[model samples]
Target chain A: MDRKAGFLFLSALYITFFGLPAASLAAENICHQQGLEIRQAEIRATPPNAPVTGGYLHIHNHGTSMQRLTAASADFSGHTEIHQMILEAGVMKMSPLKDGIEIAAGGHIQLKPGGLHIMFMQLKQPLAPSDMHQATLTFDKCGDVPVLFKVTKTPGQSDSAGHSTGHTHQH
Target chain B: MKKIIIIAALFIVTLIGAYSLSEYIARQLYPQNTGARMQLGSPFNLTAHTGEAITEQAFQGTPSAVFFGFTHCPEVCPTTLNDLTNLRDEVTAGKKTFNIFFITVDPARDTVAALRDYIPYFGDGITGITGEEEAVYALARAWGIFWEKNNITESGYNIDHTATVFLLDDKGYFKGTIDYHESRDIALKKLERLTAIR
Candidate 1:
């Protein structure tokens, strides 16, 4: 083929394959919110008819000012709340935080197993293994970031990319 | 044609005989402790996370990993659960198969709902079981679990119990126990070996 024709074909392919989808994703704002960027988001699987599940992720503050994560929401649960694992007198207890989780300016906070996390309660149904679900994380500043969570039999079972759905933390 | 037919028939007979002999040898070598062996091929009858009656019988015919713990347990219980979670992940990554059960000795406090909230914090395939104090005591004793509740100076209490994970075969017979102190990789290797032993 001639150079001009080849260039036109390549440009068409790029527009069809990459540009269109990128534009749509940008319009949906599935990755970034107001000023905060969600780095890695994951959810751990729960057994059949379980009432609750755990969600983990990392939040990075790209803005100059610190921001507080007030709450989170997902279609998978009736309610979502921020919780912290605290050691009180040798007991590891998980308590819901009334105040939102805070991320320092230019810093990052990790929501992992045995640490701070998002509690998904009142599950409508059991999260079966091999099922993938979407959760929308709402920040006090970032508004909302849509994340995809893959439900596996165990936590931290995702591929090296670190994208997963459900509560997965290691001891 | 007649010779071929006869050979095929002999091959089928040999296959059946070998299977039966292997089964007999396995039984002889693993001579089950009848008194210690839980009801074979029966589902577990325990309490659910909601405090209702749950029958292991409901989940029959699947190899399951079981552990005994309490909700008030601070370190060991959660640590073991997390370990089990890690083990489960490893097994899945290797395409292995198994189920898990978390039986609570603190029946008074670890109701079905409380377990419902607590157990799933670690992983998904784990089931939490609780029951009447007497039933729990009997089950623990039958499984050779020794646990004692010690009251602290403050308000709470702690249970010092055996930290071992019991493995049940698909037939619901007790296979073995994975000790608590073992490393995760070692425990997973043992579990994989146990499951691979047909």
Candidate 2:
């Protein structure tokens, strides 16, 4: 084969094998919504027979107006709800909010351990490290933003895509 | 060469059989307790969230569900309590009699008044209890409940504890613990099975 033809052939192979897959992966990671960004989503680890598990994330408001995140859903559970973790008289108390969590323009809300977060209730089955669950976060303004939550062995461990920090130990 | 191959195949088969048999025997000798099939029985008593004294005697002739958690716990406590609320509703709809109890390990912080407000948040007829540390410890030990105080700083401390919901028959003895992550239906089914046993 001619040198020029060989070089063209190699370039075509590289694009087909590497470039296309990388582009598709990037597209899969992208959120469908324009102004909403999910940062640092994580799920807590508990024993097999435990009743409940927790999820944490950071939501940034990139739009011009304020937005309210009212509800969340995980495919693994029957339902998910937003909860606030409060310390009353030195005891940590968690309460559910009828009204959804709000993020003002240019402001961000953090869902971390020992604080406000989401609770996955009535798990259909035991969550394993190999599993990846998808959740749809519904907002008043931004509409429904579908997020793929990657299950981890513990909190603070990043999902399979390796974007955010995992669990944090409260000392 | 044929003899050698046959011998190697036989050795491999023997090794596989040995491994499978050992695993099966080990499982039989020490069965794994998934905490799913266990039934929780009750009868221990302590102070209520209303600061009123209560005893297992008060719940006599009625089945009750008991959960061991402090009010300060953010995740497990509330979620379990909420599940209990749903469980109570389901039981009532089925026309069965049942009571729910929340025993606080952090009595120092979770006062009866606090429990009164907290317990009722999930549902009505739920009782929250707190007592002296030694008394609570004694009850916890008897039930095989495990807990430890952690993150003690200059200002405060956090506790790490076992999150088990104990189920009690009308007679108030430990029947078994509800699996921590069981669905409301599965848990209700287990409760029904326990209550039906004569």
Candidate 3:
């Protein structure tokens, strides 16, 4: 615990001295060391004036045992929930998972549209595709996994196959 | 007796083949006639995001895609809406009138502003409509939509409703329904058929 605190203190100082981008990368690397791995983390950004958005990412339990992402916190919203979307009896049902979802040993779960996802409600402001945001996911055993959520263009949308518009966030 | 048995077998095969062909032809000729299984639509009234009173009659003269969902949903709503928007963009050309109607079941919270900001984000020619719970419920019932509130939260609740996108013709007849979760190519084919047949 002391070592973790020391690392966070150094990271904060690094951010203050330099900038957020490098510190963000360093923070992600720190999160990777904590045993919970996040891949392809993206936040869906809509048009202006919208107050909320959805987030998707792949969480892998790199540790030898199972890990549970018990809760998640974000700087942008007051509330965060792990929700499930399912189609039952011809009805599309979206409901929150009261008991957090589990990541099996040596396995992973994908938080995606039309399946499981994270809901960020009461956003401080609208999410723009050009912007990046930070979210911290808490695990049952792995502690805090801070991630830099890259804003992706609206899900299930893109230009024609050949008529390509360049991605805004290459880095 | 052997000749009679052979003739009888041939006759049965021809009869079955003729029945199958006729059934195929009937489906093609009367594609809008979903009356055989379930009726497609009925009268509905609601307020559009633009704050104008609208009804089922407004969709009478243009091919429309009707879907029922809530604004606060995490995925299916936006994913399906994006898929439908892409289908519309793929099928529409030269001022073809293809309208998409998004009806919210959670009208208590899905206000005009919420929908106004949400629906247009998908694509143009789409209208977000909501109203009193009774009004929205009536519309859902008429369209054979099964929607109910579940997972209630302090902020709001998520709605369990049909995710199928109904395809209606210019005459307000039920042509068919495209399950939005289906592959985009399949949805595109149905949309293209709706436009080409028009």
Tens digits of per-residue lDDT, candidate 1, B29-95, equal 6565444555422234677775667775744566778887886554457667877877777877767
Q: Pick the candidate with the highest lDDT.
A: 3
**Model 2 chain A: lowest-lDDT 10 consecutive positions:** A162-171
Candidate 1, residue A40: how far the Cα is off, in Å: 3.4
Cα RMSD, each candidate: 16.7, 22.4, 8.3
- Looking at every candidate separately, what fraction of the true A–B Cα contacts under 8 Å does it contain? 0.00, 0.05, 0.57
- The interface RMSD value for candidate 2 stands at 12.3
Best-performing candidate as measured by DockQ = 3
Per-residue alpha-carbon lDDT of model 3 for B106-134, expressed as tens digits?
88878887787778788788888898888
Residue range with the least summed lDDT across 10 consecutive positions in model 1 chain A: A162-171
Query: Clash number for model 1?
Result: 17
Q: Answer with 2 or 3, whichever has the higher lDDT.
A: 3
Q: What ranges in model 3 sit over 4 Å off?
A: A1-27, A47-50, A156-171, B1-39, B93-97
Q: Give each prediction's DockQ, rounded to 2 decimals.
A: 0.02, 0.03, 0.37
Docking class of 1: incorrect
lDDT of 2 by residue, B1-198 (tens): 999999999999999999999878866764532223332323456788777788657545777777788755546676677667776777677677577878777878777766766676677878877777777777777666767786453434446666667776676655666755556688888777656544
The chain A TM-scores for the candidates, taken one by one, are 0.70, 0.70, 0.73
Give interface RMSD (Å), model 1. 8.5
